[model samples]
Target: GGDNLKAAIFSAGFKEGCILLPLLGARAEVAFGPAGLGDLYVTSTSPFGRNRTMGEKLGTGKNLEE
Candidate 1:
């Protein structure tokens, strides 16, 4: 993915700087997007994040779509 981004930049001759940040305190789908750069990350806000207040939901067998 990093390589892909670099390629997109190099191939396009992009020289300007841009900022990219995961929207904080927002749903991941909304935070990222149709152009989302990275694979799903486990952040503090994610339901499965480390220190998950309710524990990693996946380990508990919760459906991902729920």
Candidate 2:
């Protein structure tokens, strides 16, 4: 050890993995609920993703509906 030094960190910017145990349980409950109705909060990280739709609409100066 150099000068008795210790360095460790866990952060989003550092790309550390987080175990979302609470969120996992909540998501299961939401999926089981009838009102949830398969609305699993989807987003597009691909060309087909609704993200692209939003971006296109934004470029066209049109408001995305839902």
lDDT of 2 at 63: 75
Superposition error at 15 for model 1 (Å) = 11
Per-model lDDT: 0.41, 0.39
TM-score of each: 0.19, 0.27
Q: lDDT for model 1, please.
A: 0.41
Off by over 4 Å in 1: 14-66
TM-score of 1: 0.19
Q: How far off is residue 5 in model 2, in Å?
A: 40
lDDT by residue (17-52, candidate 1, tens digit) is: 112232234444543443232222333225654445
